[model samples]
Target: MSNSASGMAVCDECKHKFQDLKAKRSFRFIVFKINEKVQQVVVDKVGQPGESYDDFTACLPADECRYAVFDFDFVTDENCQKSKIFFISWAPDTSRVRSKMLYASSKDRFKRELEGIQVELQATDPSEMSMDIVKARAL
Candidate 1:
């Protein structure tokens, strides 16, 4: 767990779990949240393997900020199977300003700890990170 100058620390469990998702295929997605009391980023929820994207999205609180990683698998034009890891910053408009600011500020350092993210998404609303947008970015 590395602590950035901003006083945000990435908990060890966060890194280990991400490695499991990225390399071991242990989870479909992982949701992360900052523990304001400790100023540390921690794993809040994990979508089990075989969980649909909708399930992953459902795990996010509509009125809070969260960071998540999804393992997206799709077929290419050549019919080749490929998977892309996405790092998403979810900050709904209804969330508190302080929460949003903390998440935004802590994102980079937290993301760096999880090594293999291939794409990044910042979404303030569901429309911004719709499946269509994710697919376009994946391709």
Candidate 2:
């Protein structure tokens, strides 16, 4: 599909495909907004199962920060095994608005890749349990 993050082509068919495949395989991805912005990201590869959030949060520049975190995992995986979590934050734009366009394009491309596997992605706001909640629900 078109990788233009400004409402990529996959957005049109992703929901339909997801609904069709939901019964066969439960593929879900969720987005969370951290309470504050992190100046830097600190993380380790392959965090321990069941303790990913702890490991992930520990990597932040501070315990409390505003950021967007994306989680991709299968619902059928009871233990959240093989789950992948992505944390992102905006950086100073030396390239002016060009970086924003690049990010949008990248996001659109990402959506297409996920649609290929029938994954449903949902973006939500930050809440009291932003970390714990995601840790509990994951994808």
Candidate 3:
């Protein structure tokens, strides 16, 4: 997955071949439009377990304005990108947009990750938590 953000990112640390199931690569970019230019952000990390994935993009932007806050807890709308495993989003430049960083895995794993994210984000200091909503799209 190619993301525009250079900050902390969610990377494919392991790329071993899988035989049990065909693994299709998926990507999500945390993006924000500033000055009419869409800026891609980094996904800091995911929590252990609810809601969705707890991805921390650019904290600078989320803290900068109310509109740029990206959520690591829950998504209120339908998925923007439709991947084999999860949903995604994109920008006009064909750059993958940030919504939720989804790892196609067991349904149980997905549920665990989602729940973990929700709990972690909720535990964070309200001031430190982000309000940015990532609209993920597939490229």
Predicted structure with the largest TM-score when compared to the true one:
1
Residue range 43-114, candidate 1, lDDT tens digits: 999999999999998999999999999999999899999999999999999999988988888888888888
lDDT of each: 0.92, 0.36, 0.25
Candidate 1 vs candidate 3: which has greater TM-score? 1
- Cα deviation of 103 in candidate 1 (Å)? 0.7
- TM-scores of all candidate predictions against the true structure: 0.96, 0.30, 0.18
lDDT by residue for model 3 (55-114), tens: 433322322221111232233357453322221221122222332222111112222222
User: For candidate 3, which ten residues in a row score worst on lDDT?
Assistant: 13-22
Stretches of candidate 3 exceeding 4 Å from the true structure: 1-25, 36-58, 66-139
lDDT of 2 at 82: 52
Task: Report how far residue 49 has shifted in candidate 3, in Å.
Answer: 16
Ranking by lDDT: 1, 2, 3
lDDT of 2 by residue, 1-139 (tens): 4433333233333344343333333323222221113311122122233444445444433322222333445454465455444434422233236434444344534433333332232322224335555445545
Clashes in each model (backbone N, CA, C under 3 Å)?
0, 4, 19
Q: Please report the candidate that would top lDDT against the real structure.
A: 1
